[model samples]
Structure formats: C-alpha cells, structure tokens
Target: MTTHSATLREEIEEMIAVGELKPGQHLDETELAARFGVSRTPVRETLIQLASMGLVVIRPRRGAIVAELGPQQLVEMFEVMSELEATCGRLAARRMTREEQQSLLAAHQACLDARDAQEPDVYYYKNELFHEAIYAGSHNQFLIEQTRNLYRRLRPYRRLQLRVRDRLHNSYHEHDGVVQAIVSGDGELAAHLLREHVMIQGQRFSDLMASLPQLRQGAA
Candidate 1:
C-alpha cells in the first residue's frame, strides 16, 4: 500500500474509534474514496487492511461494514489481551536492559504529564508508546508482533475507557506499579499487575457497557 492507502486506513480507523463509523455501518468504497479524495483502489486496499486488523468485515455480497462484536466477543478479546500484556510484562521484567528500562520510565513520565493535563487523547497516544516500550522490552520478536497486532485492534476500546470518570488518573497509577515491578525485575509481580491492569471487570466493565449506547447514538 502507498502512503495514501495508509493514511486512508488511519482516517477510517479513527472514524470507527470515535463513533463516526458505528458498528455494522456500511462502508461504501466510492463514498469513502470521494470523502478522502482518493481512488477506489486505495479505499479497497485500506478496507482489506482494516479487515485483517478486525476493524472491518467484508462480506461476499453485502460489501464492507464496520465489525461489530457482542458483549461476549468483547470480553473474550480483552481476556486474550490481558494475557498477552501479562506475558509482555513478565518477559520485560526479566529481559529489559538498563537503557530499555530508562526508556520505559520516560514513557511513563510522559503519561503522567498527559494525565495531569486531563488530555485523554494525548494520554491515549502516549499510552501506546508506553505499552510499545514494554512490548519491545520483551525481546521476543514473535511475541512482540502478536502483542502489537492485538493491541492495535483493541486501541479504540482502550481509548474509550480513558474517558470514564477518574480512569486517566487510575490508569497512570496502574502504570506506576507496572513500571516498578518491571524495573525491579520482579517478573511475577509485573505479570500480575499487568493482568489486572488490562482486565475490564466490575465497575470498569459496567462503565464500558454504558458508554456503548452513547457511541451508537453518535453514529445515529
């Protein structure tokens, strides 16, 4: 794909993430191409890329639509995500070098600034850098690739969670523990902290569920 295709894909992904493109909403290639000032070929390629990332569904006759997951599907994906993150944390604790640890600390400090500024979008992008640092610190290429793919797939939901009351502060605090455990080389503790951090349970789950209706309404 060219730069145009990549840019198109990101724009569409952003739309889906922020609810401009809702679950199950049809995505007409022609319309998208016109909207983005691109050719239909690039739109088609972009849709295919998004489909691989589990963001778009291309049907035999029905064409493409934004992928829709039920509550159960969401839970299952997050369950896998939690495990992947835990493994990354565990390996990072054991494998990261001094330089990598310092990088991770830098990422964490960036997140702190974003949290204090009450800028969820800024924090969201910064949070990606923080997690990516840990993923790279794991030092296993295959695991890093798999973890990154799933993390990108789950980006929108994670971003949405930041908008929940006090979630930004709480998330930063959670990162603090994760950083400490990894920097201390406590693999078990790091794994445990990361698992809990990634899991959506109790009130967090309720908050995410409550936010779905508003997302749908935005599309409507």
Candidate 2:
C-alpha cells in the first residue's frame, strides 16, 4: 500500500471504530475515493488492510463491510490473549537472560515515567515495548509470533483501554506486580499477574463498548 492508502486506512478504521461506518454497511470504494479526493485504487488497498485486521470484510460481490464481533466473541479473544501473555510471562520469568531482565526493567521504568507525566499515548507505546520484551524473553519463536499477531488484532481496543479513567495508573501498578514477580524468578506469580493484567474485566468490557458506540449497534 502507498502512503495515501495507509492514511486512508487509518481514517476508515476510525470511522468504523467510532460508529460512523455502521456494522455490516458496505464500504463503497467509489464513494470513499471521491470523499478522499483520490482514485479508488488507494481506497481499495486500504480496505484490504482493514479486512485483514477483522475491522472489515471484502466479499466476492458485496464489496467491503464493517466487521462486528458479538460481546461473547470479544470476551473470547481477550481470554486467549490473556492466556498467551501469561504463558510468555511464565517462560520469561525462568528463561530470560540477565540482559533480557535488564531490558524488561527498563521498559517498566519507561511506563512509570509515562504514567507520572500522565501521557497515555506515551504509556501506550511504552506498554507495547514492555509486553514485547516479555514476549521476546520467552525465547519461544512460535509463541512470540502468535502473541504478536493477536496483539495487533486487539490493538485498537487495547489502546482505548488507556483512555479509561485512571486506567494508565492502574495498569502501571499491575505492571509493577508482574515485574516484581518476574525479577524474583517466580514463574507462577508472574503468570498469574500477567494474565490478570491483560484480561478485560466485565466492567472494562462494558466501558469499552460504551466508548465505541459502533460496537453496540445492530448490523447494518
């Protein structure tokens, strides 16, 4: 995809995520192209990327439509993500080299700095690095790839979690627990803490749905 396609993708994703693109609504390539003052080629390419992310679906004759997951489906993805993260933490606790441990602590410190400065966006980026450190530290190539893929799939929803009132601070404290457990080589506690860290609670789920009104709307 070109630079234009990448920007268009973000725009369309924002529309779908915020309810401007209703669930099941067809994404007319021609209209999008006209709207963006570009050729349909870029819009088409943008939809392809969105389709890959489960944010849209490209049909044989139906064009593209928004992808909406039921609440149950959302919960299921989070559960799987939590388990994967837990496994990564468990392995990293016992398997990480001294250098890896230092890197993980550095990531955690970055998160603390972001939290103290109240920069959710910074915290969000730092949080990704922190998780990636643990994922890499797991030393399981297959597991790293799998977790990274799912992590990207869940990116939008997880990023919004940072905007939840006081969520960044809360997440920092949670990270503290996981870091301590990992630093001490307590695989069991590290696993447990990491699982809880990523699992979206019922209240958090509702909060996310409320924030993204499109998520609660009926199919178009």
Off by over 4 Å in 1: 1-3, 18-20, 60-62, 215-220
Question: Which candidate leads the pack in TM-score?
Answer: 1
lDDT per residue (tens digit) for residues 59-151 in model 2: 998798888766787789999999999999999999999999999999999999999999987898899999999999999999999999888
lDDT of model 1 at position 165: 85
What TM-score, to 2 decimals, does candidate 1 have? 0.90
Estimate TM-scores for all models. 0.90, 0.86
> What is residue 84's positional error in candidate 2, in angstroms?
0.8
lDDT of 1 by residue, 1-220 (tens): 8898888877787678767887899999999989888889999999999999999999998899999966687788888999999999999999999999999999999999999999998999899999999999999999999988998787778888898889999999999999999999999999999999998877898997787668656645
